[model samples]
Target: MTNIDVKDINTLTLSILEGADSYYRWIFQEIKPYLQGGILEVGCGMGHLTNWLLGEGKVLVADINKSYLQMVERRFKNHSNWMGGIVWDIQEDPPEDFPLSVHTIVCINVLEHIRDDLSILKRFYKLLPLRGRLICLVPALRWLYNPLDKGLGHFRRYSKKELCEKLTLTHFRILTLRYFNLFGAVGWFLQGTVLRKRLLSSVQVNWFNRLVSLFISIESRIPSCFGQSLIAVGEKS
Candidate 1:
């Protein structure tokens, strides 16, 4: 594993994980169809998403934090399809032994941390085979860039157009690009922009999780152009 500075964003995620199983399940459902053949999940934080991806196919669960990688390895050690864990720093070149040529790559809520996001996209392009898919999710709306984002080491929030432009520049054919979690935008603005809190309140997360199914139903029916985050599916050309 290459040496890279790992940001301490675990605290920011743990609260959400405490009550957000349904939310994560929804996300998994959205991206499930694209997860086929060999799958490489970048920034497999705490293995919340990794737990779902493990049964999909052969999976390489990776993260910049060695402790997280170890945790994932221990969690999935007995699974036949598990390819183990690696300390992967997206900003750096993948090691020679790294399985860059995978059918699908899942990178969720991670691109914002890298200063050179386009370069990272380009790297993803190189790592995938022709017509391979890259499913990514990142915080949306630059106007929502706040103290929480700064504290979490986010370089910038992304607009749908901005994310598409980056994918195009990296020679990826856009498959799906849209806003997600429309209702959560309000909570994000309240906590991150208005109140300028560095972490989400456990109470807020619990409430959100309780009502997530209803929010998902409403968001599915509406034509929404803005939300708390953007989800994009791009295919290598």
Candidate 2:
């Protein structure tokens, strides 16, 4: 079983701190409707979104990193709906005790790290029951690939067509497929592609966080064809 360690914790923590609450809230709103019954969240990094998901339903937060799992366990130890954390590697066969009948599987910014993403999608299909949902988010646009993507150990960014095709090939019926954060596309291009920076400045991130509400308002009115990330919802058939 191959496991990935994108171990830039300091940068990750900074990003979470600088990120706007509205951004995560918007994402939660988008995926909330599909999150019924038992849920599993893959790559529950630093419990940023995991904290929010806990309020929605019974959620099993999983990550390959033991430290993250331990942190999540400690953070939500008192909550009844917090199903505890598990060490899960998406590239390998799930543990025998892994819950296969979960109604929803949520994966965010994780698929790009796996070289064999389609195989992982098939595994996700098997883990879910018939008509179960898979909610995923990944960086979008091949042209945006740069030093930052490489530094993050990303295999590749994805387009809407590519994501939908992969999900469809793995026996998933596409429900929602769209681009997100149109404003982010410009910043990613400038920093990652043009400037070729591998890390984001905390100051800049803080500045952007302050104006995130405005960005969300403006981008929400625009079409989803232009953005820095793709968000997809699929149902097992």
Candidate 3:
């Protein structure tokens, strides 16, 4: 699946995702009711999700990587209400300068990268207002753990039970947890068992991304017997 050159996944996937309205909307709709006050997107990478939800609300894109934020800053330097991306390391205590009580925080496909996911969840619990929501998306299933996972610095993929236990222990009421991107399971299996690699061509990545987006757009109507990622919704109590 190595054909197209995307330069960087964080920035390039945004273009591929532009055609994936249903996929974004599925997630957007799930978080819409919770989008009040302000939003802090942890590990926002190149702010693809930020750009995806442009003009939606008061948004602050944050990440530990300044280089990544540079790319993101260049992308959204002109939009009003663009709260802008900042350097933030979730594993560390929040910088006093950061507005921690922003009502909403989004951590997308990011928890798996942290070795102490619970600690970070606990931090978010403290950072939000009472009953505030946290949007979490993690790569799902142990079988999907491949070289690509390691290459991108992922610590682990998650099962629903494991994720629920961790968040529940940290005092987050589990709202929703389900599998997403069913077709991508095929690519994951191939990569983990066959190719044993992480490099992806633009065409293959885009095509598979589209296929998974198609499945996830209708994931609500499907059973949870398949897929390669988990998106869980929780609220601080």
Every candidate's lDDT: 0.84, 0.82, 0.74
**Candidate 1 error regions (>4 Å):** 1-6, 15-18, 99-101
If scored against the real structure, what TM-score would every candidate get? 0.93, 0.91, 0.84
Which candidate achieves the best TM-score against the true structure?
Answer: 1
Which regions of candidate 3 deviate over 4 angstroms?
A: 1-26, 99-101, 209-213, 216-220
Candidate 1 residue-wise lDDT, 133-166, digit = tens:
9999999999999877777778899977799899
Let me know the TM-score candidate 1 reaches against the reference structure: 0.93
Cα displacement (angstroms), candidate 2, residue 237, comes to 1.3
State each model's C-alpha RMSD to the native.
3.9, 3.6, 3.7
TM-score of 2: 0.91
Backbone clashes, candidate 3? 4
The lDDT leader among the candidates is: 1
Model 3's lDDT to the true fold? 0.74
Worst 10 residues of 1 by lDDT: 1-10
